[model samples]
Target: MPDADRQDATLEWVERVATFCVEEWGLTPITGRILGLLMICDPPERSAGQIADAIHASRASLTSNMRLLTTIGLIRKVRVPGDRTAYYRIEDDAWEKVIQRKIAGLGAFGDIAEEGLALIDDANPARTERIRAAQHALTWLRDLAARHPRDATT
Candidate 1:
């Protein structure tokens, strides 16, 4: 494909990723765009101004989102010696961190379900069924994750 075609395709794919992040992960479109761009951008790192330009977002909006991503471990700030400009790059294990957080959330919900079960009186199956099902599903997923460990070198 020609360079222009490849660039267009890449932008389309990035938009798709942005949509997924918005609908599934509750992230802002700009945040998703930043992630999408960083994942495929050359050199694996870009400065704040460059990121803002690439995603068509304002520096004002990008600042908070960048801070949030950095705090959450999805991305990090890098400083080149003597440049005084802070660049951003996706973490090497960003996806793993995301998955780990999701699994932890599931486990938290399972604990909440357990508490709900304890609140039920007289061992009522009907009252406990929903909570039990939730707990069971979470446990199953946790077990599955444990059984199939991710390879360290991805």
Candidate 2:
């Protein structure tokens, strides 16, 4: 197969993955496309303009998404001397960190449950028991995450 055909195939796959991520994972298609492209592209790093062109997104959209990715530590920014433009690249353990953070966010929901439980009177046995059940379940999950580390693959 010719190199051009191969490149087209790869880009098509990336677009498909981006669509999947958007529809199933609640991420913007552009974010998924950026990640997909970076994962497969040679050099492993791309300037914002390159990513924008590859994903067919506006420069402003790429800037916004890149900021979000960088803030979440899924991607990192690189600066080469004498170059004004910033390049973005996926971190080695980006997916692992994403999973870990998601689990941690679940744990943080316990505080909301605790607040709700406090609002209910203890004398109301039925309502209190229901709230207690929810709190217990959430606590169990949080504790479970704490006990078991996030898997590298997911």
Best by TM-score: 1
Q: What is the lDDT of residue 153 in candidate 2?
A: 29
- Which candidate leads the pack in lDDT? 1
Evaluated at residue 23, the lDDT of candidate 1 is 100
Give one digit per residue, the lDDT tens place, for model 1 in 1-154: 9999998998898899899999999999999999999999999999999999878899999999999999999999998899998999999999998887887788778878878878887567887787899988986766666676574212
**Candidate 2 local lDDT, 80-135, one digit each (tens):** 88999888899999878877776666667765777889898888899888877777
Give the Å error, residue 78, model 2. 1.8
What lDDT is obtained when candidate 1 is compared to the true structure? 0.88
How does each model score on lDDT? 0.88, 0.83
Residue 71 lDDT (model 1): 96
Segments in model 2 whose C-alpha atoms lie over 4 Å from true places = 80-85, 121-133, 150-154
Listed per candidate, the RMSD to the true structure in angstroms reads 2.3, 3.0
